[model samples]
Target: MTQRFLRVAIALVCLTATTAWNDASSAVAETTLGIGDKAPALDIEHYIHEDNGFGKVEKFEDGKVYIVEFWATWCGPCIQSMPHLVELQNKYRGEGVQIVSISDEDLETVQELMEQEYPGKEETFAEVTNAYTLTVDPDGSTTEDYMRAAGRNGIPASFLVGKTGLIEWIGHPMELDEPLADVLADRWDREAYKEQMKRQEQFQIAMQKVNQLAGSGKFEDALKVVKKVLEDMEGADDPRSNLIREQLTAFQYNLRLDSGDRSEEVMTFFRDQLAEAKKDARELTQFSYNMMASMQQGTDLGPLAGETIAALKDAVGTADEEVMPIMYVLIAQMNASMSNFDEAIANQKKAVETSTGRTKERMEQMLEQFEKMAAEEADGDQDAEGDKAAEKVDAAK
Candidate 1:
């Protein structure tokens, strides 16, 4: 990774301790599901049908080593990994390894892709489905359940369930062969497996609460829930918590902005959020600039000007090319709001100089507008002086 990326990683590591958002540690503890965790109960519906080469198609049964893989047809990685999964199915066929690929997509969407791949060969499709279960999750229940156990950042995430009806491993299908071999050999760590299952179960409960709060638009409440969940994780840092923390911070910022109250209470609340968000480099540098710009436009500088400028200067020093220009624009706007005209002009000039495309154009327009507003104020002042002079002459006469 680049130096900038290294810095960001360090920042996230440090911030993880301070953040009280989603805690995968607690989820892990509660579910006790990990590398060696027993796979939780998973009864994925078999939605597709396929006929056999010699005769009729077959259906699937539960309580087997079902390799329930979460994938999407549209996902490139998922597509790339499908063939490997097919190979695994051929290799592990009747030995009790059930490979199931399920999508949250509709039947029509999945059927279209399958038809394109197999043409008029419904028999082949049915055989494939029975051998390697391909199904859809309509209400997202199965997806939710699995996500709680193993939070997938993207598609092509697979879970290896043992014949004892426990999740053996959760990772990419490409990595499944080694774990599969181990499970087949009966050379697995049973203790670690049980602990991982516990963690997965905990994560499931935490995620359920998180989803419900998010669905209800109770973002603040969701944040609270996430904090409690993370606390339960007992300081264990996981990618899921990090992702949720990033999202929750942005959601909080948006909620504060959209409230439209503008009272001291509101301003103080937003200012505190901006202060707390510094640890999360992603949210601090990315969304905070947007918040700062909005504050400048709204003229709500109860206490954010100095705080924003300081934070932005730090961001400008550390931010990559992608975020640097925005930092410049936000600092310039904050300077302008503070009436530090020279500093404002310098920062705005830098914003225009370093930026390109639509951003540069926008900065340039802001400079022009600031100049016009200043000139108009100057003209008004001169007219007022002329009136004062006329009043003095009248008094002397």
Candidate 2:
């Protein structure tokens, strides 16, 4: 994910897990449309901006690449991705690649939004987006053909149409760079991508089965299935297989952590992850966050507490400024979970200091909360005839 996207996602959740494989795979599961299918026709009701010399596309002509994208006036991520899309269009326009971004909103709504001043800039959205084909399909036929037919329920989704007029790929527009480059350079593999989709479908099935087993209080059965799936998938080298493995690995550790009698097993899995992820700040923070997220009664990460906090601190030094607040807060929660209230307060203070706007406001409230809990703990200690009490507390639930 881009730093801009990470910043935005962090606004919604303190610790955003890497884009869930399930969400991406859902986009791949098709109804009447999918990758490798013929490109749907352009059903333009009003082409709002074609002034950059890229005229409105009336049809998917052979020998030309097209990016048929769906977006909206109210979608913030869609708006955030526009500049990058504009850059891509400008970069590839000479190569017969045209980007057509369509929205289902009325022309009035589209015009009102585009004419307004863009945030942090003096230009309007129309000016910022004028270099590409921006339009409104007021009748919803285009959206139904491309989006609904593919079982897609999200916007800012791009469909890459290859030179042969076949739909080459579909995904979030931000992730379009690599696939777009491949298609433009003739390095794209439709067959391998289909296999990737097939593997993802298989993994999805396994996940559903494991979840069912786990839900039925049969964690032992779930672990057995997890073991079998990993063993079966061990040698697959496709990108989707690798990603599924990563997700399954996460699921396995979380499963063990959630199983009440598996503390030693959970800690051992974490040790291996920590050793492998030590140099990667994002990986380490995700490891720590996932571990914290799995903690429940009888879930003991106490053995790895010192090392986990140390890894998170190291990550803070290397992480992006926008990513630091969440890492610090994760550290605070870990410490708070271990009843190390003083450390929790210290890290939360850092979280607040490094944050701004809504994140800062939220962290400040958390800081005050930590301080209050610490004071209450101290008072309880004093009330107990000056004897130290090892009262356990946890912030993650």
Candidate 3:
């Protein structure tokens, strides 16, 4: 009986090991779409304003020329592509082309986020809401369907679906102006567009997954996804693939700091990153340095303080007039972290003097608050000294 039980236990262990290995292999396996595959279908319940100026719902048509753009409130690239998308929608709406910018964010969250982003512009807000068919699918079934059908891997995935409900073209938004125009004009070959679609579909799935994770505050999980892509890039010869690797690294660094794991090691990590990053890498450098400064949390910035201060000072000398005010405020923040109150005050004062509109008022308020805090610190020092003298007097008595 003991021998029989041992044999059974060994067999179970072998089966479990085989199952774990298969799961691991499946996780990394790529399931990309190719030509002739039926495009995944989704029921996107698009929204528009009602006659009462409240809300109305419309479903996507089955056979129509449409572009469904997956984007988010926080995506910089998505934001950058908005004007072009607006232009495309305006130009194509008359041609039976439907352009819907759908998101996984719910209606209330979308409204609140839009309010913050659009500010006082009701016209622009309403135009965006209507023109792009800004509908939300909280369960993300639409997003999943799109990704699975188009082989999409990221946000800002623009799919040009044909009147036959087939994916004719899919790529980044930048490709829209040319390819979309050709596709709409009936000048683009279906086979060529379908081939390009497959390539982009394979390329974007990891990016889509990363965006999904990051949007949900799953930074660590996003990092893992990006890291896997980076690892897979070792043998790939694509320039855009290389760019994604660098961007993912920079994003992971920023997300790591944001997750409250702001140790000196993270600061050092960014410093090393800045050194290795290309000289033309302005945005990543700025993000890294800014996060590094923030890690100080108002404490004295030690040796690294001079580096941030110098970088800001150099930036100010050549920065465009529009960007100088922002640089000035960052410089002020660095000086404040060093406890150089006088220098901090001077920098903030420069920002206030040079800035216009709401920025100027905000900078002025910050300067005033910092000056008050400095004065209070001085008063507190005086009180401490006086209390020490009083203690000596009482002891003598």
Candidate 4:
């Protein structure tokens, strides 16, 4: 644990109120499916978008590539990926490619979503999704065969079937371009890809154990689970392996800090992250928030955050407009903690400008408090000066 790592500095899953991974990903109990295997039958109950001319696939139709995506109306990631799926359908529909999105909800739930207007568009959800095949299965029969059988519980999981009725790829829909192109051109190395997905699925299972241990307050044991995986994957340089390794390495610090004991190693890790992420606003914001939150909890991070306050503030310069307001509030709060009321007030004003609605009102209120504190400090300084002058006059007399 003391040795240096790649220091990839992945984002930490936050544990503010308590140091635990609050995972929202859906999970299945068992997996009987794998890449390079035959895709399950398209046991659909109803095609919601059938009336829009987007038909269905009764089974894995031979020679036509299919992207079977599992999603739900309530899953945010699922909803966000809808536009990308539509784009893929447009690009490949004429090329013998079909995109079928399945939801495990009832017809009524999916129909309700169709009635709502699309974001930033006048069309309804049904209209926006008319380009792709949208279906709902109340019985969850298709989900059992695809999602459950694959040991997948996450929404927006896309299963790509190659021309031979075999499942070629399974992953997020947004990342489908490269692999889908490969499958279309017959350039896919199914054997190698299958191994990669297999390893990743195993990694996900290990992560569940790690999360359990961390949530149970057994931080050391939780770290051990990650360490074992890292050790097993020591020489693997594949993107998925590297990403998982990096994520696990960064995740160690969270477990360590939350274990009611702190180490120099953990402190050094964040200190290095603060220094490395100084130029990347999003990364800097995340790192700063993680450190600052711990600081508020009285975790003695050895002034790691205090000493690097200037660099954290520097992120504000490079931050995106949406992120700029958060930087202002973070800086303002840190300044207020050190009793720099004027600086805090300035930042609060910036926050008020960048934000709207309730956020703006809250920032305005914080600005007032800082102004009041600054005025009181100014009056106290003037009284001190007056007393000092009176003492000088008495001495002269």
Candidate 5:
């Protein structure tokens, strides 16, 4: 995907984590179902493993609470949350709670992954996830019944089903503890949760508008919306606010740079942001990468290229080991764009040396390409010299 599309996708997905849910009536209008709605019945086609003293629970039973989680093996967050789910299962097993982890991947793929050894742990996936029930939905009936029915579009989604077989809460797996406890104790305040959902609905609507404006290349209009959000959002120091501010600044800089409004002023604006972003390695790396990608997309940085190189060098000084290799690769690309072949080769070598795996292999390939270009340039110069000498001899004759 293009960088712009990718950024918007990430923003939309992450906004859900920060926003609250809508009221039941409004949520039902917005989605197929909402909290307090009866959950669809379990549609497990087959069970891979049913441990934890609970075997093949084909349906939600009375006097029992269920944590029905949808996940996949390729999801990093899903894998990380496995241990937490295990802990929850162990803690609530006596309280009549069962955690079921469901995946839609093929049985062979799931089996291989379950049997394969993971780094830092010798336990198979089956052994590691022995505390909870494991199942595969080849027909996707379970996912359609739960995730699609609830209007959830992403993975690692969780539903806390109460004793009455109603969805008490729906959110990320990590956000399940408090709601689970409340549902177990019969103290969940449905009204309050509904109000929170309403607020979340508002946030979601606003974010969609902002994303649409930005996607349409209306950066100035988008900046206005961003400013409005920053001013109106409740918490000034909220991470979401900070993130939007960063985006606003970046948009403003791009707008100025694109318009050619004030060359020196745009450079100053970018340099100031670079200085502030350098303190955070992740932000610095991301900013630098975006800049590099923008240049590659044909946005000429001109004199700003030197400034960007300098800023990248400064970022490198404070960047952690993980980010260093990427920064080096960006620096090498910048130098190559300026026809500084030797410098490009040197920086690329450093990147290759510092990186490993696919990254190292890719860098090695780039290094070879750069070496070939340099040799071609040398040969062209030699050809020019020979032509000039021939001309001199012809004039003498």
Candidate 6:
């Protein structure tokens, strides 16, 4: 496995272990609810709002579509999407569509938050959220029935329940409009959605296996799974396919680098990939960064350093304004590693000038360090010259 991939996998494993779910695999397996499946019933403990008035709703009525959204007041994205949800509710109210915003917080917490004043706004939380139906999941019955049953581990999740009580779609609330329009117009394609979900499920299963093998230091085995995924996704226009291909290439490159006999082959591969990446500024920047990172990790690039530097310079010539600064920093590091301190300091100074925020601050710090190293080298050279002159004078005497 590539270093980046391994780091990401480790982080994901740690997160999954600490989550409320038993394990990552179980969490993946539990997502059994899919399109065409009958949606679970709404079992809310308390209804906070009902169509401009306060009341309760026990069940979803027939011939009416419902948007069951799970959200919390503290979730920034959830709060940001509230007004959009309100707008959607208003737009579809005449079509018998109701948006039910469910929060798992206790009734007391919800009430207090609603009454509390918000920062930079005259309206309280309750005033802003009064347009849609709000409810508290005091016993988590609605959550268990809807969110858990669908194997959803994150909030801001939404499900569109068709008039027939079947789930037509599931995704983030922000992406609800397109599918909602389809469902209301009686043109939603269940079969296509099922196929799409099946592909995603298969992809998740493959990644889980790859993660397991990689986490155990069995990269050779993990490589096989990665290649299989790439093959399975070949010729597809899916973004995931491209991501998997990149991972596969990185893993292969690292494995070859570790092999003592494959030096020539790996160097050739690097040259070819770098040439291809140079066509795009962003791609070249990423390529240069990865190469520099590998060098920092003690990988001996030897003659490839010169080649990489040349390619980076070419990339910089055509790079975008925002990307040029990052490329310059990498180039500076490459030059410094090659003992070309003058060029390093110059490029780093340029980086400091072009960058902003924390990046500019960091580049300024690196420039200072490079300058110090140059000064030390110069002082050492002068000391050596003085010693030689003294030795010559003593010999002449």
**Best-performing candidate as measured by lDDT:** 2
Query: What is the per-residue lDDT of model 1 for residues 205-304, given as tens digits with 9 covering 90 to 100?
Result: 6666765665566656766775675566665454444554454455454545443445766677767777776765556654455555455334355556
Clashes (backbone N, CA, C under 3 Å), per candidate, total 28, 0, 5, 0, 4, 0
User: Residue by residue across 1-397, what tens digits does model 5's lDDT show?
Assistant: 2233323323322221112122111222247767888878787876777545888777789989999998876554576577788889999989999888889988887887787554235677778788888888878888887877776766688888899988888877887888899989999886667655555555555556765675576657866775676566645453334544565556667755654444777888877877777777666656666566555444677766777788778777666555676677778766765567798789878878875443466667767766776677678889999999999999999
TM-score per candidate, chains pooled? 0.38, 0.66, 0.47, 0.66, 0.61, 0.54
Point out the worst 10-residue segment of candidate 5 by lDDT.
16-25
TM-score winner between candidates 2 and 4: 2
TM-score of 6: 0.54
Q: Enumerate residue pairs that collide in model 3.
A: 153-204, 153-205, 153-208, 154-207, 154-208
Which wins on lDDT, candidate 1 or candidate 6? 6
Better TM-score candidate (4, 5): 4
> Can you tell me which runs of candidate 4 are displaced by over 4 Å?
1-28, 51-53, 261-268, 271-397
Candidate order (TM-score): 2, 4, 5, 6, 3, 1
Least lDDT summed over 10 consecutive residues: which range in candidate 6?
A: 15-24
State each model's CA lDDT, in order.
0.58, 0.75, 0.58, 0.72, 0.69, 0.70
- Model 3: residue 379 alpha-carbon error in angstroms: 21
Model 1 lDDT, residue 258, Cα: 43
Residue 265 displacement (Å), model 6: 15
Model 2: per-residue Cα lDDT over 1-397, one tens digit each: 1223223323343322232212432433457887799988887899997567878787888889999998876554576678889899999889999989999989998998887765456789889998888989999999999988876766678899998999888878888889999998999998888777667667766877887888787888998897898899877998768978887877877777667655666778778889887777667767776665544233576667678888888779767665577788778877766668889889989988886544566777777766776777778768784343433223231
Off by over 4 Å in 3: 1-29, 32-37, 45-63, 116-124, 148-153, 190-397
Clashing pairs in 5: 21-197, 21-198, 22-197, 22-198
Predict model 6's lDDT versus the native. Answer: 0.70
Cα-based RMSD of candidate 3: 14.9
Error of 6 at 328 (Å): 23
Taking the tens digit of each residue's C-alpha lDDT, what string does model 4 give over 1-397?
A: 1001101101111211111111222443677888878888898889887675556788777889999998876554576577888899999888899899999898998998888775446788888899999999889999999888987765668899999999898888888999999999989999888777767777878888887887776778888898898899988877777877787788788677766555778777877888787867766766766665554444455567566568756667766554666677667666655557778778868877875433455556667666766777788889999999999999999
